[model samples]
Target chain A: MTASKPISLKDEGLEQKKRSTPMGDALRQFRRNKMAVVAFFIITFFIFMAVTASLWSNISFLDAPKGFKARHTINPAGLDRVDPYAEPGHCARDGLDQGKAWCALLTEEQRARFPNSCRVEIPDPNQRQWCYILGSDGGGKDWMTQTVYGAQVSLAVAFVGSSVSLLLGLVYGMVSGFYGGRIDNVMMRFVDFLYGIPGLVIIIIMQVYFREISSKYEDSSGIVGFIVEINKDLGGLFFLFIALGLLSWIGTARLARGQVLSYREKEFVEAARAVGARDRRIIFVHLLPNIIGPLLVAETLAIPGYIFAEAFLSYIGLGVQPGTPSWGEMISRAGQEGGFYSNRHMIYVPSAALVMLTLAFNFFGDGLRDALDPRLRGR
Target chain B: MTNVAKSEKVMTAPAKKKDYGDPIVSVRGLKKHFPIKSGLIFQRETAAVKAVDGLDFDIFRGETLGLVGESGCGKSTTGRTILQLHRATSGTVNFEGTELTTLKGNSLREMRRKMQIIFQDPYASLNPRMSISRIISEPLVVHGIGSERDRQKRVEELLERVGLNPFFANRYPHEFSGGQRQRIGVARALALEPSFIVCDEPISALDVSIQAQVVNLLQDLQRDMGLTYLFIAHDLSMVRHICDRVAVMYLGKIVEMAESEELYTNPLHPYTQALLSAVPVPDPDVEENRQRIILKGDLPSPANPPVGCNFNTRCPVAIDVCFDWDPELIEVLPGHWVACHRVT
Candidate 1:
């Protein structure tokens, strides 16, 4: 026994004194990818914008109407508001401001002081005036402020929805896979039944009905009432969470179940059983760590889908509450009105933002999969 | 290089056989059948792979009972079924005195303190994600045998006991070589101080040079701890040196059993004779001169084995009775048992 007992330092000398787990190594690999790093920073910037959405609305130069959530006009005298549709410089050429004194030359002095405040371009180069920046939707809301604040509502649905789905899918898949028999059969059959029904239609119906029911019960004093009031305060994002979370987990559940089923029969599990470890311990401690990598990659890639689902719902005019400034709602309101033909900026600005965030998530998810799974790395 | 060569020299040199005490583990009609279910809508059990059709053997205390067979012959199944790792289709495995087949939940776990298994593939058996310390101490932790501090000490002790450096406990399974990982597996099996161990082809996956060192380490551990082993292997020579008695299996049933040296020199069953003849002797003169009895035909499927003797399909010498009536393993010469109608 002594002949084979010596510690070979040369072989083990390659190992570091500090033991970093596989997850740590995967994180390091992910950091090394340039596009993934760029995507991560872009996503982080969106989250930062999301967190400071209210700050943008309050600090803008345009006199944002007090206590008005949706509309942002330039001043109290906005009724003769340059007639945004008729001509770009309708107020400026020959002083046709309807005898309003400030509109003539006093506004010219204010424009000279804060030139960056106006982002809208007038077609007339001779007499352009300061106006709504990034143009205005039909509702008169500023495009820049709407896009910035829309991140709050859009991101809330993205995060809370996916987290809820991940939770439910993990528990459902683990139970179904770990106790595979009549129980697994019954649980999976239920999922298959749910799969047969069109998921988007059900979510739409649920969102509409839940909003009605919540508004009706918001004053009562129980859990339902508490949830209703919270939903109202959250700009109807609570019901969005419930709708997206309950239905979207079906795909994740299927993914997780497959991962669990494959790892359940591996020799390490049999080894754990032979050591007298209980079923619960084997599933949670031993089985979970091995299967978690692929599940995580799948979830990351699925996040972009969640963001798009919210956008789709809002685009059809059923997304968040009315006053909540989601990019989808802005696009829907813009395009549904005559703004699609009249103002090009209103449609493309939010569309560009929507495209950027979702693309970043997709890129980051791809990089994560390659980092966590070596077999998929080069390919 | 000299260490491996010297150990190889010692391994092939047959050790003195010693007397064993009463059976520490006994099996009665052990069977393990894996059902093959087919059909899409209405699933039905069409057939079964009778891996261990029916086996009856005793692994005595302080002795190694080697179970040898070709790949599909159910040697590993016999060992796993005895330990209740694979639930017996129908049989009793009495470990010391407790009937292991009926035990479940905490009762089976408590009884598992007396028995353990060493898996075949060292890489597959140890979880890659877990550190080496966690792997070796897992059994002790599961059985609630010691406190956290105590388990750490025990892990180090077990590591060193299996001829591994205790300092390497923090490293993962991928860091170690095949021989070292096998030793780590050995350490895990020995964690709870089990009296009986099933070494399931423990050295087959190691290098030829590393194989000798691991085999010698197992021998040393056995002598010092007085542990019983159901050493399952395909290697006839390695089994001869390590095992006290050896059993030869064919198509899901044990065909012959006797002292290792006796079974090798005087094989009663035709299948065992064919198996031993296939092992080339080291001495060229004797190996060339020896009459080789190469049996014809591949082994019959265990799912639908031929009637009468399980080995009758490939058996070299067969009588008319060997095709109809199944022969029971009966003692032909006091300690030597053979299941063949042709055997007296």
Candidate 2:
């Protein structure tokens, strides 16, 4: 007898099923886009790195060491006596031989200036200063630990700032687009006025105002009492984020406003209105969902810009003071040694990290932008 | 003067014969004029766009009343105003026994449950992002009816009733063809089991073949569900086929109203006579025999309609009386209404 294929599922009894939830359909569609999935993974990796900074960093970055003395400190007298280019204890190594070799390169006048150098140097074994894995700066602090720890603070500011800006922009844009007319005019005019000001000037003003307040609190109370009363801990970072976000969100507000204006004219909005859905429901539920894709893309693209700004500010000594380890501080150190060119490692390491982080955000943001675009779907 | 009196006598000598029960909807002296503001900051009302200048009609129970007009004739505006979609500047829209214009909040929504509208573009009428089931279930959800399972079952029934496969309920509007999408729109409108529907040129955007199917489906639904309709279209041929009574509109006012067959067979008003003569008869010989009454000039702007009869500027048979005083809508025959000084 000929072998017969078993009855198929469709033929057996089951009927085709249809999706009941629109949310499920949208989520399924979102998952099918490979670039969006990759972006999701990349974002998750950065978030993981940010949250686990303590485990990654060699030093406890959160705790600022106030009284710890350096194991090695160069004395001013020693600076004059010792040859700057010679290795540690090289002055006493075979006294005349190595010292003469170092001196041979010098002119007769330079040798006369260092008359007592040969007797002044004392031979010492194992006299090397502490070396970090990524090597120490001129101040003998590990850059590897500092940079890893710094990522947390810089990333936090960018995320928090973008989030704050997104929230404010959404509210302002939605209200303006929904109410329209005079309310829209008044709100948009304020946004336009804010946009007219120089961004850096606003940032500087905010930083100075915050600094003055903190200083006033410090002066009113002792440092310990001030820490208790003013309570500037991570709270300070949050406040800074809020300040940056509030000052920098005009662009996002305008973009969101334009989106809402177009979205409000769509047939779905009219249908919602005709159905007697409240103004709030129509604005928030009907119109907002349609514009969320653009907003999300805008927010992702904004993160790297904010990150670069924060790093640039820190490089100029205007951001994340001395105690906080930042990529900008690492870069500043390299440049301080007469333009970080002599020690290329110092410059490239932090600069490379910053470039990598910014590019990762941009690449992922581009992926999200493509995935979120309604026109790019199904293919 | 003697000939005018003789014509008036001829107009209303016939006794009343048709009465399709009492009217479920009635509008009287409805007027909506929107002012034209100029000069921005030093704004002033320059003029007014009389969107629905003055309209009076009665939609009888268990009947489809077709309102036919060209674009800008305020047919859609009249429907919207009657439905209270636009807060009328001044009008009385009495539905059943209650007034619609004065009702607010829950009462108005309750009124909406009894009456609904199917829009021109099927693609736009239903929310594209919402699933077919969700789109159909919206009115039910908004009105707070039944449990989720019961609502789902009802949605499926409505889908089947409108001749759509129930399995397609999960699909977004974009997934369906234009005809299927229109069926989904019909299903959504039928979900509430409303007594009256404003078919606002529902099939105007569809294929000619699909238009007939939709019109037939609407008629079948009307018969099966005992639903009434205010069918608005610019197509006179379709109006004659589907409507029990037809009203012809020009500019912002109804110029003539009569039984569909009678209106097609004999149009009294000059504009109506011209419009009916323009529709080509399917029989070529008869079409050749007919005299086409083509009028001069384009439709007058609703913002600045003629001072007298709205159609006076374009009417081929317009007289001196047509340009002096605005004619009022009045019944000339037992059931037919017309607004023209010459007709009286």
Summarize candidate 2's per-residue lDDT along A89-150 as a digit string, tens digits. 22321233344456667778877765543333545523623224454455534455566666
For every model in order, the fraction of real contacts preserved is 0.48, 0.18
Instruction: Give lDDT per model, in order.
Output: 0.78, 0.72
- lDDT of model 1, residue B119: 80
Best by DockQ: 1
Candidate 2: misplaced stretches above 4 Å? A1-40, A59-136, A219-231, B1-18, B34-48, B277-297
TM-score of chain A of each: 0.80, 0.70
Who wins the TM-score comparison? 1
Give the range where candidate 2 chain A is weakest over 10 consecutive residues by summed lDDT.
A61-70
Point out where model 1 deviates above 4 Å.
A1-4, A11-19, A61-135, A211-228, A337-342, A374-379, B1-17, B37-46, B282-297
